[model samples]
Target: MNNEAIDIILAEDEPALGMIVKESLETRGFKVRLCNDGAKAYKAFEESQPHALVLDVMMPELDGFSLAKKIRLENEQIPIIFLTAKSQTEDVLEGFDVGGNDYLKKPFSMEELIVRIKNLLNRQEVQKTAAIYAIGDYSFNFPKQRLTYKDDEEVKLTHRESHLLYHLLQKKNKVLDRSFVLKKLWGNDDFFSGRSMDVFVTRLRKKLAKDDRIEIINVRGYGYKLMVP
Candidate 1:
């Protein structure tokens, strides 16, 4: 809702349907770019890096799931909403499993789509808090999206990784409740998101492994504690 001309990449093969959705969003002050195939959509996404992505499940060259995986490697926090005709319990679960924020069945109302986009964007704004956090021998800057290793090497962290690190460091020396972390960082404690969080913790462990004095201790069924000696 800032009316700041949100950029979106619409990947739908049906020419007429694609135009309708594109125009509808554009009418509401969004900047929409349409791609007829998944390959082109990926290329467009790489070039534009839109605020949110609307992808069709079935497409040429590559499917929506494939395109999403590639996008997640480079950009982690950007909103991804799957717009597809495949409406099954498993399908929805699969979409979220692959890092999607939301999944919409085809024939969805424009109003519903708009609401989901707004929700995703608003959640993103909330998640963007303090950029720089002090960890052992490293400064984690979430906004710049970089991790400085104190002249050793500057490594970049994915958005989720950076945010997860910040949350843990903020609670340094105290036990960070796992459920609290899952809800705060990912906005959900669902199975897929929980697994995704585990992956992030593993990556963070590698990043912080250089410092012997710093440790991330799993508190059994509770959560984690970041300790500095």
Candidate 2:
């Protein structure tokens, strides 16, 4: 999205189709590494660590599903789209079961393939910056401003408390600069704003006291660090 080329690994046995797909993806600014067999693709994946994979179900050295399972063992988050001529229900189910994120039947349009790749990447990015986070034994839902401990009733947090907690969690175990947080939440790092942040931090400490492993420590001359084991 920011002119950074997306890298893709494509494993296809058909020479002609493989070349066409490679050229099409490159034309749209994707850096593609085309492998003629599943074995070669696996090797390429090890070396390149591409963002996503497009694999043909039937290959020379290994099959796509097997390759996907192997890759899953190494990395679970990479998006995989299986390309195959077979459209059986079991085949589709097997694809999902074997860690394939999406399945595309053969004779598919390049445009459709591109869309799926983009969509999967987008979904993955969203997951990386999810609103829900786990803090020791507590679950913090940023959107709802609720913190729940085990099976206990959820504690409703104020707007400032929720925002402050989110930033602290974002930099968990590291000192979050006081000035940066002040400007982020209150638009200024004045004396009153800093005092307000301290109050909110105190309130948060009380709420999170249920979890003994969690701590919000003030770093003398620096800021606060949310410590979670």
Candidate 3:
């Protein structure tokens, strides 16, 4: 892994622990900014635009779960690791349910955490095909969550929107099962998440409306189809 390519936002309420971890990562050539609370971490995330996040599940003001959910609203693909004392099966599941890519138990070895970070970053990089896709008159950069319309400026899509669009495009002219998508994304095939998915679909529709040839058709009571000419 290229350590130079990484920038991290770490949030831990314990000041001593946070500093130690920050210094250790910095020693290994990672640019890490440590914050003691979730709200400060979020602000740093917005300002620094870090490549990954290491957040404590229990934090002052926002807490890691809430912060992670907030971040997911705008960016779904960024890597997040929850470093906390909570280590129950349910706790780990809860971390992932909020869009975290990984979870580490408290009292973890900094070395182990480093390895996990590298592995997660490498894994995500491997997923990128580095190919721009054509959807109607728009060009999509899936890795960047970007869509370019020939007649106007580029549209930046939220993480959920981008992933939903990807599935639709891959299954073009075919049905993408509603429950399947909900389970894969929100970790549950329930009514509330289904409604949330619908909201995302509507947002995508509006964004892609410029291209008349691109149609996201909902297969009533089933799923959605991305019809491309």
Candidate 4:
């Protein structure tokens, strides 16, 4: 077993180039799934659920932009890198709008590609460990989404509840931008989501009510504030 270091889906139609990239990454401890065409790449992606993507913009059956958009519809966090020959400003912007994390122009250095991938993975790890927070008498384990109270009670939180609490806690003593919270969690700040956010906030207030020192206040017309005294 080669330790499958970082799972990468490589979608390059050129057989020789694909082999070179795949061998290069594997030698460096990355587990790569090489698909010669876009359709096969998309299928492999769904089946293997790789950690990241290295997709060529021009491919048979489906282009990189379409594939990335499809994946983003299901997952917003997976890092996607577009390997393209087109370096037009509009092309780059379109890639970003379709949820690309980075773009590597054709004729790029393999070393640079490796570095970018590592940097993106590192950044994700950093974002994953936002910060453990202390609210009132509770210790929030953000990574595990667990809340421990009084050293004896560990409360597991639902995904929504946990993420909502994280955002609120991160802005302790200040207003949590309502729009930002909605966009980050729900992917939008539509009327329905805004209302739903209000409901979730109310639920959190009740959940943390055990500690009188902890309060989540609505800062009318702005956002909510988590106050820990």
Q: State each candidate's clash count.
A: 0, 0, 0, 0
Minimum summed lDDT over a 10-residue window in model 3 is located at 184-193
After superposition, the stretches of candidate 4 with alpha carbons farther than 4 Å from their true spots are: 1-4, 131-229
lDDT of residue 184 for candidate 3: 60
lDDT of 2 by residue, 88-207 (tens): 656765776587767778798999899888876875675467678899999997656689998576997654577689889999999999999877655468775576678779889999
Model 4, 90-162: lDDT tens digits are 6765776577767778898889888778766664675586777788899887666578887768876544577
lDDT of each: 0.80, 0.84, 0.83, 0.80
Ranked by lDDT from best down, the candidates are 2, 3, 4, 1
Candidate achieving the largest lDDT: 2
TM-score of each: 0.66, 0.58, 0.58, 0.57
What is candidate 2's local distance difference test score? 0.84
Residue pairs in clash, model 3? none
| Model 1, span 92-132: residue lDDT tens | 65676576777777788988888778877886886676557
Best by TM-score: 1
Model 2 per-residue lDDT at 225: 100
Q: How many backbone clashes does candidate 2 have?
A: 0
Q: Which ten residues in a row have the lowest lDDT in candidate 1?
A: 88-97
**RMSD in angstroms, candidate 4?**
10.2
- Give the Cα-based TM-score of candidate 2 against the true structure: 0.58
